[model samples]
Structure formats: structure tokens, C-alpha cells
Target chain A: MIIEGKQRIWADYQKEIADDHYFYVRSCIRQNFFPASEVTFWKIIRDYVHKDIFENEHHSSCSGIGYHSDVVPFTTTQAVVARQFALMTENGYKNLTSSCITSFGVYSEVLETWKNFPEELERTRDILYKATKREFEVPENVAHTSDLIFKYRNQINDMAKYRLVNVKTGEPLNGVEHIGCHYAKMFPSKGVGGAEHPYVLAGMIESWGGRVVDYPERRACCGFGFRQYFVQANRGYSVACTKRKFESMEPYKPDFILTNCPGCPYFLDRWQYVIAEMEGKTYGENGYGIPVLTYEELAGLVLGIDPWDLGLQMHQVSVEPLLDKMGISYDPVKKYLGVDNKNIGQPTCPSVLKV
Target chain B: MGKLYDMLKKDVRYQEALKACINCGTCSAICPAASFYCYDPLEIMEIVQSQNETQLEELLKSDKIWYCGECLSCSTRCPRGNTPGLLIMALRKLSQDTGLFVESEKGRQQLALKRAIGDNIVRTGYCIYIDTMKPERHPESGPVYEWIYNNRDEVMKRMGANYKGDGPGPMRNIPQETLDEIKKIFDLSGGTELFENIEKYSEQKAKEMGLQFDETTDCEYFNEIFTKTTKKHTL
Candidate 1:
């Protein structure tokens, strides 16, 4: 289940889970495009949630992004993931959670398949063991942030201290939840529900007393098939898929769409406007044109967390309507996001030195 | 072969830059243009590395090559610093330089359109400009021309230029040095003759194939000439 907002989930998860030693997996796109979200999510989990997450210098990228481009070979991807897993094992972190859908999916595949494919696993283990002299075993459970959030849902709901009053027409708010493909599609048998009608994120939203709306293209990929956008002009199909999702949700007139993965929010929010312009349609009338926000941001607001503190302004589209819906007043000048912004900071990577 | 490999090796910056990729397929999955087209960035890198001439040839011949919208979303999100979009552009340059897939029908048509558009731009610094109010005098021969006519203002806005109605007017504004440079490059690339022949051949093929031939019209003439040229030249 997907619970909207940061405070409730963070507070509850902190109280319930004794195992905070997380194996944080890095995402390629998030590192480059949306670094702020990555930094923010980790900071909240570490400081506010008081989770003992561990990130080490020895860990490298999972290489799943390059695999689709056929740039990197499968063996090479296996080697990279194996190296990361070995590092995690050395650090005594048994559970791995990734912010990126691709990293989560690729790593999960490698870990889950290792048990059945001993020969392949042996090859990867031999290479890393010979190189670093470190032995590794695939964890029993590999999860995305959504999994952790779902596991600790009841505590999240109990910790909710504030309510959002939709200032837009003085009514309560409704939301549409976006279930990321990587999280939902990684393991079909684990039964997180089918990728198309994933109840993980939607269930969390409902638990928060927010209604979840299902759109026609609810299962459509967020057109972020990585290198496909850059090399070709076929964005029309991806945009159309996103447009279908918006059209399906339009009937509900949702206050905002909430997502767990950063990439989905970027594509769904920005591409919604682009498709509207291409088809000569305005956003609110024929299209829901609702602003997209991360589940953390939504939850933070309902718990009376400051919008700026939640990094709400980092979004491409204006979050004023969302804030208005949540009955929160924000000063545009005071909340301006810039280099000096308090909410913005370097990632937890050792390469980033705190000023 | 050594020289070519050396050249590629020296430009190993592109390869090393891309080493950081995590293989998330995010670039391919999010690519808008890749959704409908057969072009795959990952495949391009594989072919580039393999130096497979046949694969390169096949890639250049496909219509998917021309379908890129030049959006930089892939580069923006690519975990590795590689820009597959830019890599495709480099391959396009290679295709034109080597003449590997120039005989394809779409290739020839594109060549013709490029020449016609280039020449029109050179001569007038603007595409075909006729008063929209005088529709009787300016007749469109095809659906393409009709669309251009209907969306002239929109097209102009998109291109970010204005058309002046003065005689022998806008062409003079472009620098003579720039025009000479363009011509020199066109000659060096053998594009001028290729474009001319394309137009000539298309018209002939249109008639020979029993296709509607509107030679009286400039657009139709150009289309037929290019089609015929492509048909005549297999390799």
C-alpha cells in the first residue's frame, strides 16, 4: 500500500522497525536528473525516521540502465550487482532497498535467480571474491522503498497528527496513486498484485483517508524507457500512454497524483502539459492536468510539515494548487528553491562533502 | 581499418563516458520517439562497438533513422554520462559520408527534400512564400503542400522567422561567404548532384509505374523526380 506523505510513515516506521541497517541502492537517473529527491528521501529516513541505513564507498552502480541499451553485457551487469551485494554483506546489511525502479528490479532479479542458478551465481561470486577477498550471499528479501512503506503501514496511519483541508472549494481531497513498474513488475509470484492494478501505492493512499482513482492507462510505462527518448522521435506513443492515464483519471478530478518513484512524477507531471499543448487541449477541462507529487511530499503536508521542508517547490510544475488543496499557505519568495535552499544538500555518497 | 579503429579509439571518451550506465532501460523506456520507431540506443552502441558494416547499413536504410525528435531526456537521465542521442547523430553523419544507405527510397526522398528546402532557403532565406489571400494564384498540388498552406503561420512561428514580400529581397540578406561555404560543403559531400538526380528520377519513375504524375506542379514534379531516381539506383 502507498501512503501519501512523509511524517506519518517516517514516524510510524521508526517506532516499529528495529532493523534500520538498510542497504541503499543508487539510481542512475535519480543521481543525474533528480538528485534532490534522492538526498531528501535518505535524509528523512536517516534523521527523522531514525533508520540505521548504510551506504559504503565500495558499492558501484547496478548497471541495469545500460543493459536495455545493450551497451553493457549481461555478465557485466551481473558483476556490478554482485560487487554491491558483496559490499553490503561485509557491512552486515541484509536487506537492500533502492529508490530507483530499475535498480530495484535488476538487483532483485539477480538475487532471486542466484539461488536457482548456482553456476551463474558461482561465476559472479568467484570474480568478486577473488578481486576483493569478500564472500557474499544474496539476501532473503530485496525491496524497493514502497515495500518498506507497505510493511509499516499501520504505524504510519497511527502517527498521522494532522489532516489536510482542501482549500480549493472547501472540500476534502482525492488523489490518484501511481505504482511504479520496477516495483510492481519485478516479481510477479511474490504477489504484490499484477503490475497493472497494483494495490501497494493505492492501498497506502486509502489508508490515509484519501480516495484512489484508477485511470485507463494506469499500467502504462512513464515513457522513460531511458535512451529511447533521446535517439528517436517516438515520444508520441509514450506521451499518448501518459495522456490516456490522465484522461482516465480526469473523471475523478483528483487534487493531485502521488507516486513513489521520482521518474514517474517527472514524466507524468511534465509530459501532461506537453501532450496537452500538442493536442491543443487545456489541462483542467479535457485533461485532469493535476500536479504530480511524491508520496513523501503528500504525506508531509497532511502531517502539517512545511511545504518548503518537504521540497515541494523542486517540482517542474507549480504545486500551488496542491498546497491550496491541502489548506497550506506558502510564501513564494520565502520558499524559493535555490542553491542556498536549506532543503537542498549533497547526496550521502562520500564524494559529496558537506560545506 | 587500423585508421578507423584508431579514430574510434582516440574518441574513446564516448565509450568511457558511457561506462557508468546501470542498464536500467530507463533511457529506452522513456524515449518518446523510440516508442513507434525501431531505433534502439543500446543496439546502436552494440553495433558501433562491433563495427559491423552490414548492421550499420541496415540501420541507415530504415525510416527509423530519421524519426528522432532531438529531445535530450535520455542524456539527462542516463546513469552513465553517454548521450545516445548524440551517438545517433554521429552515425547519421557517418551514413551520409560513406553513402552506405543513400540508395534507399526514403533516403533519396529525404535528399531531394533537403536540396529543395536548402535551395529555397538559400535563394530567398525563406520557404515558398505566397500570399494566403491569393489562393487562386497559389494552388497546392498535394496534401503535404495543402497542409503547409493551411499552417503557414504556425510553421513560420515554429521556425521563428518572418517572410517579407519584397522582390529579390531576403536572399540578399544572407552573407555571400556563408552561401559559398554551404555550396562548398554540398559539393564536397556530392549532395548537389545526388539531389538533382533524385528530383529527375522521381518524375520518370512516377510515370513508368503508372502513378499519378502532376509534372505541371512543382511539388509533384519534385516528388516524382526523387522517386524515379531512387528506383533507378539500387546501390
Candidate 2:
């Protein structure tokens, strides 16, 4: 009965879930920092969920960064979103899924703004019309890709090739689920379990047989606030926020950090390196850092994709330790292999700070 | 040009982000910025709600307003459903729009951000491009990144990304038609004008500071703003 109620709640939580077809929008940071993660996301939607996804090169950014950075106003942002919607309408896909949490939040706020002031929609319409003679119908179901992943966690678990356990020890790997704040924090109800106990990443962690370790700073922001991190003067607040989260979570000694948002994974991973440089501080056992992966990359790893193929080498904190625990084998030299399938010699000895 | 209070009343962001404060201090308590910097979102809200034009305008010119990470964490826990993060957004928008953003150290970084992100948006259809993600700018990306910078195509290709390829996928070549459309949207939606105003005011500030100002991203003022770190928080 409890199981039934749980499924029922999930059912209601994702009532408007896209029907295996989506008009996909990309995240700029995701492609930059973790290119293969987005590629892996597409593979998951295709191979695991068997969803029909349409990705267009024409789908420009949601301009959420510009708007939040204060260089762009609401009118410009709304029009950009409307332009995206018009493209989706042109493509005939009604269910829209954004890869970035900020874009998802921006779209949600724009939807609210349109609902509150109908004239704003008309204003966007005029601009879009002037630019592309484009008319748009608002997507019936606006969802984050993470939300979709959360909805299908059970189905994904059934099809998993490997569980999140130490293959050598048969112990469940300890993991922390860092849900991006924008996923549900701004409007709690939009998220799977709302803000306080957002299940978007947690559900994925559990489904993959990883023990979801809870820490005091679980709900804190990843601190990649567009301006906060971008401006050197304001970066302390960003670094401090990330440091606070790392300090609180370090005691748990999780094997890896898993996140849903684009910037969260990047900032959380990058700042771990920055904190080491700035303070001679390091987390995890033996001065090795925590390997942070997106939920998609984690899923891809468990699904037995090649580690290097997922751009794990691009990660500052190596994933080899986690891979060894999982007994996943790969030719180490391939970490430097070119498209010609030849080793390109060792990468410049990683210029890590010596504390 | 208009009374700032009247303008605040008209902005939907101000209307949506604010509510009856009840002065509980929850927004400040939850604010990540408050933990590190001297920011207090509750105080910012109290000042905004009090509707003192001088103070509000002062906020527009202050480094304090740029402190919000826009994480929206405060909005989640606020008992009154008020979003101080969104309020900060409204404040930032007002600051940039009124040309008062040039007054603060943090706000001066707007020109750098505009070149780095805003111009990148127009040129690449994304906020950042891989070629421009420099080793100088991104020391955190470290030496592996430098090596990858030397061998980006090879590494990216092995990773199954379509870096500057013909068709649509990760890192594919965004067609000129799409870029043209994006430019038209910016021109039509006032983003272009906003960019102009940012440059116009920033140039004035640069001249005032006796710093070199130019159309390119490598001006002396730009380099100074981009690379300088504060000793205040280094401890």
C-alpha cells in the first residue's frame, strides 16, 4: 500500500510529463565544461528511456544568464524565450525540456509573467513576429530534463547494466545528490519532491543502488550565480558558498558528487580545485578530491559507456578511483588518444597546487 | 528620467519578488551571500519597501547589490513567500538601466561580463565558446585544459562531440541563418540597445578612471576588472 501511494504521488508529481517526445534546448555551460555529459544525456533519453528527442542547432540560448547578469531586461528575455517557443512550435513539438536549470526557471517565470500580464505575451509576439514572422503556442508541458529523468528512474533501474556498488566489495557506493537550487527552490511545487526534499537527484541515486548520503549543506546553492562567479570582486561569495557545502559534505566521504544542473556540476567541481589553491584545503581521503559527475554521466558510467568517451579525463578530479571500485576497466593511454586512435603522450603534468 | 518609486511600482519583477516583509529576517538568514559578504537581502528589501528614492538609487550604484548569487535559495525558505533573490534581480536591472551600475567596483565588471558573455551570445549563439575559454582566464581549468586547448579537436572528437561540425548536435556549427535570426531578435527585443548603453556608460567610467577603454575585450580596464582578486576574502 505504501509502494502504491508512493507511485501515486510520483504520478501526480509528473502528471504533465512529456510523452516520450520533446523539443530539447541545450545548456551553454553543459556543453562547455562537460560536453560529453550532454551527449550522454541524449544517449540516455535514446537508449534507456527510448524517447524521441529533437535537438535543433537553431534553438538559441534562453538568455537567462544575460537577464540575470542585469545586462538584459525582462522584455528581451521574454522575447528570447518566445523565439525559442516559436521554434518549437515550428518544429511541432509541444513538450519542451530545457537542459539548464536557469533556463527552466526563466521559462517558468516567463510563463507566470505571461499569465499575469497577457500584454507581455503580446509584446513578445510582436517582437518575434517582427524578427521571424513567428507565432508560437506555449508548450503544454514545460519540463526540465532532470524532471523527466526523475519520472523514469524506476524504468531506468530495471534496464541498468550495473548498480552503484563497489563491484570488488559488493558494498553500495556512498553518494551525495546535489540538486540544483533552481530545479525546485524558486517554485518548490515544480520539482519532484519540492525544495526541502527534492527527489530529482536523490531518486536517481537510490534507483542506481547508491546510498544517498545526506549532509547539512545538501540544500545550499552551488554558488555559480552568473554575476557572483563571473566578477572577480564578487567571487568570494561564490567560493565561500561552495566551500561551505564541501566542508559540510566532506565528513560523509562520498565517492562522488552527482548534480542535475549544468553550472552546479561545473562550479562544484571547479571550486573544489579553487578552494585547494586558495586555502591549501582539500577534501576526501588521502588528498584526492571528490569526483563530481552529472546524473547523466553517472547513468552513462553505470550503463558501461567508456569513461574517456564520457569526457571523464576532462574532469579535474579523476574518476579512475570510482571506476576501479566499480571494476570498470579501460586502457589508461586512451585517455590521451586522438581520433586517429593513437596516444598523444601524457597531458602536461597537471598543474595542481602543491600545498 | 522618472521617479524611481513609480518605476519600481511598474516593474512586474518588483511586484512579484516583493510581499508583506513582516521584518522576520529570514531572507538574510538563508542568503548564501550574507554568509560570506556583508550582504543582507532583508535589509535591501526593507530599504526598497520603505521606498526611499535616494537609498534605492544608492543601491543601484552600490557594490552590495551585485552580491546576490541568484541561487533563489532565500525564496524557498521565506515564510512570507517573498523572493529576495528576485528582488535583487529587479534591483540589478534598475541599476544597469539607469546607468548607475558604473558607480561600483562590482558593477564596473559589467563591461567585462558584457564582452565575455553578451557578445559571445551574439557571436556563437552560446554564452561561451571553447576557443575563448582561455588558460589565462580560467586558471581553475588548469594544465589539462591547456593541453586540451592545444589538442581540442582531437579530444573533443574522441569524446563524440561534434565540435564545429556541419549538422546539429553538441558543438555543431550553428548556421548563419540561425545567428542572423538571433541578431534580429536582439535588435528587435532591446538587447542590442542595452548592450550599447552598457558600453556607453562603461566608456564614460573608464575615461573618469583614466583607464584605457576600447571596443575590444582586452582594454586595460577590462583586463584589470577580469583578473584582479580581492585580498579581503583570501583568508
Candidate 3:
């Protein structure tokens, strides 16, 4: 739903042709906390995918996090949507792609409701147009990166040339894929499959030669949005959800866990460590712990990209066990410094190229 | 008219709190926490609704009760709008009051942290404070001299006397009276003894179970021990 970073990569690979024009909506959380992930995603798209894809930076966050928490007013949300739509039109990239699931869910809901109710849209449009000297119509094309990635699964699979061999346990590395809540629940029809059992990310993992483990809390939220961990420490609720996933996947003894959304990774990575502490437990056959990884990072590893090049070590949870499981020697400092110039084996465009 | 049930009825803001179920199994069907273990939210809700103290006591004593992750998916998707998540919290509070499940090493350890937080909050309007922020040799390891030496500023900050101390403020608002009340409650709930016996009891139990106990106060080592132990138990 929120089409940021890894989701965008999935979309580009799925769509095959790089999208030149994009309504590059921003997220407050990502902008402040994970600016690099956002910037890197766009750079990858611009450098490797179609350079013609429209990129606009005028949109603000959807304010869904605040809105859902009952902190922000509904009027504020409507205003945000109105302004975002206007920005999309102004940038000549009416097609919108959300990097954050919450933003995608909010934008889609607002646009869908607006299209069905002219009076509501007109009232909001009047306020926005008067303020910005521009008008907007909810564009026909609006989707999360997941939608685009799922559409071109075969192409991505074909392009993936390398295979990651697990050095530990003498077995190939397996993963548990976490498709974020917004991507699945916000638009059921547009989703890859049943929202409860979405398999887009899992399918991709399988194609990439990794096994996808079915976890009990596979579909549950990572509890990041609730801020349950910080607000209500040691309540057992936040970690319980995480524990369910760990236990469910424990049977398979996954080498690493993959998630598309950054928020999920943040919570899963950090909270898994906390849960282990609270419960007084270790994971894996040899007390190895599970590492939360982004889909791109996992793909990069499988593609033989250096760990630091993929930013694998930046995660709060240690990826040492995962690297050991995959039998890859990782140098955190070097991996962090190395950049993927080839951008997942996609072609880079020269400045002379036209959109 | 137990305090737990009364609190749930009066304080829980969700609309589903009012819905009465006929011992239906639907909530359990979708409960993620229930999927792995034997605990069932529907069953827990039934016990609470019944107001049967015996059933409630039996439910509270089991390790299954602590498995809830509080995802609220059950609350959101319940056909009858019953929130097992809230019910579980109420049950945990009751369990703490009864001292039924506090004997377990993990439970005792939690009580220790809770007491530490409570005592520190009462004393300085904050949680635990040390001379430095660096990991020290755990108390069992005899006064982590190296950690104390290396991280004096961090320890001072944690002590609540420093400018950057994570003591109570405008937001966390841990008043002295509240801290005293919490400490009193902890004593009544046998939390003091639980906290005292954690390291001793956990080491013995972990050894019995063929687990290692590295009781280093070095925050990092304790963290590693805690994680390793919990992962083994959970998996």
C-alpha cells in the first residue's frame, strides 16, 4: 500500500519497464527516521529503472498514523488528500504510488470515497484550489508498489540470476515473509490475494530459492503503529504477536525473516530482541537468532551482492547468524560503504536519455 | 464485583466490551495467540463473564495466559465484538494480585524489573538509576568495577541526579505517593521476595533444565542471557 523502497523495487521488477513518472508521496516517519531507505529507493528507480518515470516531491504524508491513533482531525486528513491530489496534477504525474502502507490506504480510501461522493470532493477541492490555485481529480492509477511487483512476478524471477547457498546446516536458507497490513487490508480487490493469506512476497521468496515459512501471527501487525512497546512496556501484548511469528516459524527453523515495509522491519527487528530478553530465550538450532531483513536485502544476498552494499548490517538485530546461515562473510563497515551501482542488474541511463 | 471485572466494564473504551457471547468459539478461531498454544481468548472471556473465581484462578496460573501479543485482531474481527486482549490484561493483573504464577523464574524476573521501576520511580520520580550507563558486572558478579569505571557519566545519568536522567517529568508523571503505593502493592503481592529470589531461583532452574546462566551485570550480557533463555523456552 505504501510504495516505499523495497515495495517500489518489487513493483519495478514486476512491471518490467521502469516507470518514469511517479507521484512520489512522502511519509513523515520515513522522512525523519529512515531518510536513507527512501532516498535510496528513489535513486535506484531513477538510476536503474526507467529514468522517464515522473518523480515529484511536493506531497506530504497522508497523516494516517496520527489519524488512526485518533490524534489528528478528519478535516486535517481530507486537507492532506486534497493537497496531495493537487500536487500530483501539478507535477504532471497524476499516477500516485505510496511507499507507506498507511499513506496508500488513506489516499485510496479518500479518493474512492471522493469519487463516489461529488459533494464531499467538491467541498474539499474548493478549499484546496483556493489555497493553492490548482484543482485535482483522483487519478485513475493509484497503487502500492506491491500491486506493481505482483503484476510482474515472472519477469523478476527470470532476471534474478544468482542463488544464495546456505553455508550453515548444509541447507539452503529459508525465510518467513511479512506482507504489511496496509497493502493487504486497505484494498482487498487490488491486493495479490486474500488479505489474510496474501502470498505476493512469499511467492517472490520462493522464486528466489528461499522457502517461506507459515507463521501463526503471519498476518498480524508489527505493533509499531501502536507504539505499544514504548507506551506500555512489558505488557506482553506487543511481544506476544512477535513471539507467535517466531514460534510458528520456529518449526521450519528459518534462517532469516523478510518484510517489505520498513516499519514492520523496525518493530520485528527491535522487538524480537526485546521479546527474547523478556521471555529469556534463544532462537535457532545452535542458539542462533532470527534476523529481520528487507526483501531487497534478502534478494541482494541471494544475488551475491555484498552484505554492506545492501545495508544489511544497519538493522538493529544482528545479522551475524543469518550471514552464518547463508555462509557469507560480512564486513559491516565495508558492506555499509559499498553501493549497488548496477542496481539489481538493471540498466543505468545516461543524462542524454529522454523520458 | 471483582476489581478486575469492574475495571474492564468501566474503563475499556471499545464498543465490543458490551457484547455478550454465548460461549461461541469464533474468537478463538481467528486468535493468532491461540494458534500456537493452548490458551483460548474465547474461553478466557467465557471465564470472565461467568465470574467463577475458581475457573479464573485456574486460567491465570497457566503459562498460556502470557502468550497474548495484544494485536487486537481478535477485538477488531470478532463477530460479537469481545476483546480477549483486554480480558487477558485484566487476568494478568488478577494473577499478580493472587501470586499464583509469580513463582516461575521469568515471572519473578518480571516482578524484579517491576519493583525496580516502582522503587526508582518513588525515590527519584523515575526508573532504575546507576552511576554509569555502561553494562556492569551483574550484582551476582560482585560490583562490576570495570563497567562502573568505564561508564560513570552514563551511570550518573541513570541515577536520576543527572540533567539527562530518565526520571519522571511532565509526561511520565510518576509521583512520590504513587511510587510508595506501588511499592506497598509489590510487598503485598510478594513482589519483593520475587525480585530478591530471581537470580538465585533462575540460575538453579536454568541449570536444572540444562541451560546456561550468565549473571553478568554487564547490560549486554544480561540482555544476551535473557534473549537466549526466552528463545529456548518459547521455541
Candidate 4:
């Protein structure tokens, strides 16, 4: 229950807006796990926000997980990140928006490390020049896509059709916002609200009219420690961390969990499924499981996008309860429509705890 | 004439990651990895600070360092601003570089990880490809994904994804020029060298264990290491 670090006021955490043109580097894991969220993010930026976001085929993984896992050396990671910046320079993008929080953290860390040690930066620059026969300029601004959304939350709110309240009950949806650890912890000053009181996800929730739940472990890691999750033996640690968050927040009786991190939403949703299987337990007010959504998914919902279109069916812990609460309508039997409407079948049966 | 601890102190991450070790135990108390596994960040720091060659070498050969998820939760809470997560990173690097990683079960999986994630990057710009997440390998993706894969073209069209067809869209084919550029960077950036190191060290370990150690990602040794699970550090 102990709050850590020097807490910053909301005013201290204002992020500078990136230039209208952004070179986006998508997270490899995000695309595989929840492609819909990424799609929705691009759609909102282009269609709703009217921003110029660019994704060239040249962008690659930040090598963050690989670097952290010790397979890739620090030099290799530094050079790889430099290549990304080179791509940005080649594409004439002054703003860099990374899709994955981990990639964002890696970028931040590389920048920070380079700041402290210019020699490493020179080495990376030289290696990159030799690697691609290309020269480079660093982006003027670096922001996670979540940061962009958080920075423009009020604008998004202005266009939102549905509030974060239940339509039938006319009550605010109680929400718990989980910030990705890397989003702030790596460098507190760079995050939305600093490390002690990050408000990236919270800002989105509040902007969308949800009642934010402040729990003891609000800042706890989603526990997708790269190697921890990759190695099955270490997954207990990953699950234990998620369990701690769930246990800490159970008292709040929140309706849903929302996160900005690619790993957080998946782990939060999947761990609930794991906990249910391991110990016949459910925690949300409805007693099935709390529906976990990324910030983009929440935005898509507020924009009146159909529930199934957000790929809620791909989620292990059902979002049906939340969808029902929101009164978002779609055919239940027809929800499992896969690519090109081949009618991909659904899970044979629904959970007993289904609302 | 310098010890391994001395070498670590020379590393920038170690220098920046460790400010001053006050032994507050805050790092360990809040560590998620420590809570589930027989691991302690503060204790690891204590061992490292002791600068004993035997303990440091033992650490390199042990499975303990592999338990840290590198979440850097310790980095945020450390009163002295010493990040055990970053310290773990330093230790893991030293472990792998010295071929000591092959001694531990988790360390042995480095080859599997290289094949899965590292090689995936070279093949596709992604560390994981949608096509690779087969139900057999990742049943956790659930049955919904199985049906979705069987009818991806239809599902992707409905969901608004390009689904590997082409043109600027999510999940579409990454331009070939980009793939070539990525491949060249990997070769120039020591990534290929690191990959080879992983293969060589793992092969040595596999040979010592009397297991087949083919250079290819496939084969008995790679499969077992990838699939095998351990409870050695479980609480």
C-alpha cells in the first residue's frame, strides 16, 4: 500500500505534442496479440484525429525484449534503434510514435544512455551509416501512441458519442487504469504523470467519463517480464504479479481494467482466465471476470464502433458483460466472423459465469 | 588483472543503474519475480557488492539471474536509486558472454529464444508472426484463433485488416526493401554474431549433455529446451 517516489502534480506532466507527421513503429507482439487495437488506433488517428501517421515497411522490432533477455548485446540494440531513427529521417518524420510501451522505453533508454555517453551514440551512428549507407537525424519529438492519445484525450471526448457510464443503469462505469511500468518507470519525467502518479490510462478513462478506481497496486507491473513469460517455469512470477494486482483491486469492485501497454491488457485478461482455472475464482461485480481493454479499444467503444469489430471475441476473459452494460449490439452467434466472413466458429460453450 | 566485478563496474548500465547500495531490501520486497521465485534482488546486489569472484562466478552459472523478468520495478523503488533489474541485465550479459548461461535450465533456453524471437526478426520484421502462432505451439491463443486462422481472408476483411495481401495496412506484407535493410543491419550490428554465439555455446552444452546439437533451429536438443518446464525456483 506504500506509494513510492516523489509524486508530481498533473501540471508537471504535460507532454509536448508531436508534429502532425509521425513515423509509427508498431510492436511485433501487439500486432500478433491484438491487431484490432492497432487497427483502431490508426483509424482514429487518420479518420478522427486527422493526423499524418506513417508506417513504412522498413520499421522493425526495437529489439527491447531481445536486448533485455541478453540475447542481443547493448551495442546491437543501440545500433538497431539508431536504424529506426534513420528510417524516420529518411521518411521526413519529426515525431516518433512507438506502438509498444517496451519499444518506447527502449527508445527512451537509448536516448538517455546516449545523453550520458555520447561515445556510444557516435558508435551507433557510425555503425548505422556503414550498415545502410544512410545518414540520419533524430526525431524532434518521441512519444508513445498512448501518449499521443492521452495528450489529446479532451479532443477525443469532444467527439465521443457514448460516455463511460452504463446506459441502462445511468451509473458511471467504475474503471481501474493500469499504466505500463516501462511507460513511466524507465524515465519518470518522460511519462504522462511521472512514475509515482502516472495518468496516461487514467487520463483516457476520465476523459471518456469513467470513474477511475485508485487501488493499492494501481502501478503494479502486468508481469509480462520478457523472459519471465517466455520461460514457462518463470510464468508463476508473471501470474503472481497479476494476482497481486487483482487481489489488491478486488476491494474496489471495478467494472473493467484498461491499459496502454500491449503486454498489460493481454496478461491482465489472460491471467484472470488462468486464475479462474487454477482456483475457481472471479472478482468483478458481475462475478465472472473483469473485462480488460486497451485504451484504443475503449476509444473505439466511445466512438460507437461495434463491440465485435474491436476483436472482443479474441479475448480470453469475456467482455460480454461490459458490452451488455454499454448496450452495444451485434448478433452473438455471428460475432465469431473471421477474415472475409468465412464464419469462424466460436468456442463450443460459454463460461457458467457469463452474464 | 581485473575481476569480473571490476569489469561489470566498467559497464555503463552497471555504472548508471547502480548509484549506491544501502541494502534497504526495498528492491527485493517489491520485486514481483522475487515474490514467486527463490530470487532476491537485494541479495544479488549484496553478493555483487561483496566482489567475491567465487560468488559472482557461481551466480553466472546459476539459474537465479534468469528468474528476473526485468520489469525494472526495483529501479523505481530503490531508495539509493540502484536498479537491481539493470544489475540483473549486466549479470545476464556477463553470463551469456562467458558461455556460463548454458549451465542453467533457463539459460539453456537462450537458444530456443534466439530461434523463436531473434530469428523471427530476420525472417519477418516481427518478433512474432501471426502465421507462426499455431494452435499446437500456443493453445493459449484459444480456439477462437484456430477458426479465425482457417478463414483468415474472410475474417480480416470483416475486421478491416489487410491480412497479408499488400499495400499500406496493418498485417500486410512488409516491403521487400525493408526486409533487406533489416537483414543488412542485423549483419552489421553484431546481431548475427550474437546469434552465432548462442548457437555455438548451446551446441557445446548440448554436446556435454550428450544431446544432438544441429546448427539448424530444429532438432531434438532445441525442441526439448524450448518445451521443457522447470519448478526448481517455484515457491
By TM-score, who's the top model here?
A: 2
For residues A1-355, write the lDDT of model 3, one tens digit per residue.
5668757645533322224466666544343223344444544445434344454323334546543432233344565566667767777765776666667666765665566555657766665555455577676577665444444445555655444446545555677788776664544444555465566677767776677777666777665433233223332445566666677777777777777664677667655555555564655555435787765556555545565545443454567767665666666434222133212121122122110
What are the chain A TM-scores of the candidates, in order? 0.81, 0.93, 0.78, 0.94
Residue A200 displacement in candidate 1 (angstroms): 1.8
- Once fitted onto the true fold, the runs of candidate 2 whose alpha carbons sit more than 4 angstroms away are A1-15, A350-355, B229-235
Q: Please provide, for model 1 over B1-235, each residue's C-alpha lDDT reduced to its tens digit, 9 standing for 90 to 100.
A: 3333333333222443345455567767655556555546666666566666566567766544544433434654576556565555444434443453344444434434334333433342222223321233312111222333454443222222222322111111334443343343234333354444544555455565565654333455344534342222111
What does candidate 4 score on TM?
A: 0.94
lDDT of 3 by residue, B168-228 (tens): 2111223444344334433433334434454455455455656545534334323433332
Q: What is the lDDT of residue A320 in candidate 2?
A: 77
Interface RMSD of each: 20.7, 1.7, 17.6, 2.1
Superposed on all Cα atoms, the candidates' RMSDs to the truth, in angstroms, are 18.2, 2.5, 15.5, 3.2
In candidate 4, residue B23 scores what lDDT?
A: 92
lDDT of 2 by residue, A107-208 (tens): 988998899899888999999899988899999998898888778788878877778899988999999889887788887777787776677888888888
B56-125 per-residue lDDT for model 4 (tens digits):
9999899888888888888788887788888888888888777889998888888877877788777777
- Count of backbone clashes for each model? 57, 0, 44, 9
Which candidate number has the best DockQ?
2
**Where is model 3 more than 4 Å wrong at Cα?**
A1-20, A31-36, A151-161, A164-172, A225-235, A303-305, A324-329, A332-355, B1-235
Q: What does the lDDT come to for candidate 2?
A: 0.82
CAPRI class assigned to model 4: medium
TM-score of 3: 0.55
- Pitting candidate 2 against candidate 4, the one with the higher lDDT is 2
How far is B41's C-alpha from truth in model 4 (Å)? Answer: 0.7
